[model samples]
Target chain A: MKALCWHGKNDIRYDTVPDPEIEHGRDAIIKVSSCAICGSDMHLYDHFIPTMEKGDVVGHEFMGEVMEVGAENKELKVGDRIVVPFTITCGECEQCRRGNFSVCERSNRNKSLADKMFGHAGAGLFGYSHLTGGYAGGQAEYVRVPFADKTHVKVPEGLTDEQVLFLGDIFPTGWQAAAQCDIQPTDTVAIWGAGPVGQFCIRSAVLLGARQVICIDNVPERLSMAEAGGAITINFDSESVLERLQELTHGKGPEKCIDAVGLEAHATRSLDSVYDRVKQAVMLESDRAHVLREMIYVCRPAGVLSIPGVYGGLVDKIPMGALMNKGLTVRTGQTHVKRWTDDLMNRIQEGQIDPSFVITHTVGLDQGPEMYKTFREKQDGCVKVVLKP
Target chain B: MSYSGKTSSSMSQSLGTSDKLARGIGWFSVGMGLFELFAPRTLTHALGMEGKETLVRACGMRQIISGIGALSDNPTPAIWSRVGGDALDIAALTPGLRDENPQKHNVELAMTFVAVTCAADLYCAQALHKRHKYPSSMVYDYSDRSGFYRLVADMHGAASDFEVPANMRAYPPMWAEFTPEKESGLL
Candidate 1:
């Protein structure tokens, strides 16, 4: 099997590794049909989140045909097409009952497939860390899925792999942002970042019935997509976010705001970190939260703040008083892609929305590392790049 | 859940409309009107459904603010990371991290605090000379300080790591203080 492994800072490489096989009752082995580079991969490409291993396969967004299924994976079967949810969970746990599957006590990831899969300590990801449930990611030709029945969603027959590939991550993540925002029909909602997730947040906001969807980003390609979708676009470099948002809202401000941009902080054309002057140099871009602080000022007194962006566990101090004073409602989390994917798929099937609009580039699995680099550096207008292995 | 009482037949009828335009563009207006009428964001905290009152927490995201807000149009003023956020000289504080040292490094706690703060999303962590501002700091903490592990208790219900809600964030010590501002402007 071949995968883009995270060796260290700026050291991601295309390397051949072992193939995958089913190892548990709720496990399955799937041949990769399609996969996409996620924004989070930037963490490794730039070394924002450092790891000790040089061979971590770091992708959670993928979809494919299931070649085999574990004994307990009865709900799913061999030959079934699936959009693999990034996390594994026992559908029967209390957390699962409540839909918090990521922290499922039963989740397991044998990154090396060197142990039990049913319900052992599974905290590594394809290429993340030994702590995140070290399960090899779908970036490879063949990947193992833990809790297969719960993690893999059968891609409804007839849906193209390209159409459903990102449903595993970006599409669902965008939907989660929109869903978590709880936008109303009349309420104006805004999204930060024009990346794939931000684009989806805009589309999903409109699909779910936001009165107005606004997008803030420096990337022209992303802003254009938002413009086509009827979302008002603004380039933060050329304008003031608070001023423009307040003007549009008559000072009452938007009811909902979402941060699709995670820790990666970039200036007009360069990346700036507290560490130094980083322009396209790919330092730990942790300034996205700065925009969140500004969002607090523009939001209506009782507005909702939704964060679909990823954040690491270690961080600086935060403003607690301001948030509490506004009586603001905040919903931030890793998108439970599985919880709402079926609903999103239905939306796609019914033509309520077409998430594939975010797809701007596609390539074979062999080009995974290069595409990932391009996507990470924001080269080639890569809002969302797709890969087929 | 936002339109608590407006269960009008027409609303359900609109929900059933065929055209994407009718379903989205059409219902959009009704949904907005009902949203206005019922103040959906004010209700439905317990709806256990998406797009409810919790949405307001999405403060100041740039994508959401583009061309429509005050700061969206302003050039962000530069703030040194050391000034805005950085290390706290543990030597100066009363119960200095080293003095009251646990096995973990205090600065490391600050790093974890920032990580979870950013990861948690609602909160933007800056340097604090005091710890009281970070009650929810542990909301993103994996530690069992407040049993917030149950916040995102159903981890499967969560998306990827980044999109998890703050409700699931670990609650830090109610009075955790921030690192004192860097002296002489050093990070």
Candidate 2:
């Protein structure tokens, strides 16, 4: 099977690897039809998140048909099409029973190592790093899905791959980000970053009834897309994010804030961004918290801050004083993808939203390497890239 | 597990020609900067300008800064800085090409090397600029991609039928009664 493998920092290769086989009774082999390059995958491509090894298959957003199933896996049989959620859950754990699938205690095979790093091991993630179980990803012709019976979302026959592919990751992630805010009908939601997840956050906030949705980004095409999604766009490169958010909310900061841009915030816009770059270059900080700082400083008192961004390791200079004094509530975690898939899938079926709107590039698996570069650089108006395996 | 250690197919690399060139230039800049910084007297003597050790060291510092910049995620500015540094290098060497200099041939050889490096730097800079910089005139219009089937105004708050999970709620239902309209007696 041909797969995209991570070689080193900024190095992804199209290489031939052996096909996967079922390893457990709940495991199944999926012949992948479509996969995507996610923004969080950029963290691995840039070598930010640790524990990635050479030749590791590098993708998590994929959907396909079951080619083989384990003997005891009664929930699925051959030819059942499904989208594999990025987070692998056992569905019988304490967290899973409580609807916190992202933190299912039994899924991570490397629980000891993760425990050492994160204090408690969360769910095992596909194609993310060893800290998340180091399972092989779905960016190939085939993949081995552990706990497949409970980790997959069955897609109906009418939907195209583009319309349903994101159910595995970004669609549910954006939905979860908005839902975590508990947005009210009269609330104003301000989102940072207009990439794929950010775009979905705008649409989700709008559909859930926020009176105003404002998206902040420096990319012109992304800003335009945000506008199309009913968000008032702010180019942080031109205008002030704080000033504009205040003005848009009539001098009272937004009631909800979302940071969709994670560790690799662009370092050219503000003094804090420059400071973060210097700290990162000097090995003093592991993640840039500029968006986090800006959000803490500008959010209205007692507002909710929902973060869906993938932040790995440490961040310095967070405004703890402001966050405490303002009585803000912060909610952040990996998306419990299964929890929102049923609702989002219904929305897709009912003609409420189409996930394909974010895809701007599609190509063969051979072009996956170059597409990673194009997507990471945000060149050629590349927003989301889908690879047909 | 049917996985094998051997790969049966050829590998496709992520780095392109221009990317490789930029990386090579970055390493070259770093190496040259270190050499000049550590052995400025050697450089000044080789160029027949024996008293300019401090100036040579300053140029080395400039080279190192540009080199680090070139090695960063965005190398366009760093490569351009290299081009500027190349001009300064040529200007500094011109005085060493005087008729009275004993090492005029070495000075000429040094100038030739700098000129070649300058050309390479210019090419890499332009290529990186073209590859990374978004064209100001080419604006992509994605305004039609609302993802909603109906108009946004019609679809706003359509998901009100769904309830926010209890644990994720920001505040209790009683807080919802304190709306600005209600506080102002409009409701």
Candidate 3:
């Protein structure tokens, strides 16, 4: 099997690796039909996440046909088509019972490592690093789906792979981010980042009845996609996000704000973003949380701040005073992928949104190495890249 | 059967090589601690650092503390404590390295052994420290209490009203009509 492996910083190789086999009674082997390069995967590619061994297979957003199943699995058969959630969970855990599958108490096999660091371990994630249980990802021809009966959702017959593939991570992540705002029909939502998750956030905010969606980004293509999702775009390079958002919201600022750009946010206009970049480079800080700070400042008093962005480590100089003084409510996490899959699937099935609209490029598995670089650099207007394995 | 629902054991059962090595060193500390605590004269004499039984006993107490700490829920601090103890051992054994007594060669051998252990201790200590500081790559970092667990507890409780709209029935332009390419032929 050929899969993308992380060799080191800035080094990704789509090379031949061992084929996956079902290793547990609740496991199943899936022949991946489609896989995607995600924004979070960029963290792994650039050595932003730790614990990636040289040959660890990479990729978490994928959907496929079941090739084999463990005997104890009751929900799925060998011939079923399914979308595997990025965060593996056991439906029986207390966390899973409360609909927080991303923090499933039982999934992380490397719980001790996580427990030592986090005081408790969360769920195991496919193709993520050892911090999430070191499970092999689905970037190859086949992958072992742990707790298959519990972690995978059966794709209905009518859907194309592209319509359902993102059910694994980003779509649900974007939806969860927007939904966390408790958007009212009259509320205005402001989002940072125009990447795929940000794009989905725009569409989701509209779906959830936001009166207006404001998207902030410097990328032309991503901003255009947000526009297609019925959002008003603010190019951070050309105009001030603070000024424009304040103007559009009648000086109250957006009632709902989403930070879709996680840790690697670049600042075109803000001097603080440049400082974040410099501090990140020198290891003075582990994450560049410029967008978070800006969102905290730009959001209205008592407004909801929802973060779909991925951030790791300690952030220096967070605007705690602003957050507290304004009575802001902040919500964020790894997407509880399973919690929203059913609703989003219904939306996709109903033509409410075509998730495929974000696909900027498509290629075979061999091009994965180059595509990773292309997606990371935002080259050729690449917002999202899908691979047919 | 299912890797999902089972609670992972804390005794380094399925941990990787590095964790296993750290546990191994931890057990070695316990053994050495017992030896020094129970037989300080015999243990100190063997290392060619004899005649200061009180210092040897104190070192044993430190080793026992560090060993217990290493095997605890968080081994990073304990591992570093072992590292500090190694530094002290090196400093204490320096005289043995130069003594003209017949046992000087024994001290040299012990120094070499301790040097190797120090390197291992440093490597494991740094690795554990990195893991402690940054659990994920820099992108998914959170403080000790700020990661997924607290985030879920704090935020999910607030968004409990979220649900798929009751009237959002499946409408037109079903999934079958969706296609990535412009040909519109796949459907």
The number of the candidate with the highest TM-score is 2
Every candidate's lDDT: 0.59, 0.89, 0.78
Q: Candidate 3, which CAPRI tier?
A: incorrect
Candidate 2 C-alpha lDDT tens digits along B70-98: 77777778999899999999999999999
Worst 10 residues of 1 chain A by lDDT: A271-280
DockQ for all models, in order? 0.01, 0.38, 0.01
Error of 2 at B104 (Å): 4.3
Please provide, for model 1 over B79-127, each residue's C-alpha lDDT reduced to its tens digit, 9 standing for 90 to 100: 1121122122122121323434442354455446544423322121121
Candidate 3 residue pairs that clash: A48-B137, A48-B138, A49-B137, A50-B137, A311-B139, A311-B141, A312-B139, A312-B140, A312-B141, A313-B141
Per-residue lDDT over B135-158 for candidate 3, one digit per residue giving the tens place of the 0 to 100 score? 222131111211112222222223
Query: What TM-score would chain B receive for each of the candidates shown?
Result: 0.16, 0.75, 0.62
List interface RMSDs for the candidates, in order: 23.0, 7.3, 18.6
Per lDDT, the best of the predicted structures is 2
* Model 1 segments more than 4 A misplaced: A108-126, A268-288, B1-187
Model 2 C-alpha lDDT per residue in residues A219-326, reported as the tens digit of each score: 988999999999999998899888999899889899899999999998477888999988988889999999999999999988989999989999999999999998
Q: How much lDDT does candidate 3 score?
A: 0.78
Ten contiguous residues minimizing lDDT sum, candidate 3 chain A = A373-382
Q: Give Cα distance to truth, residue A45, candidate 3, Å.
A: 1.0
- lDDT of model number 2: 0.89
Q: Which order, best to worst by lDDT? A: 2, 3, 1
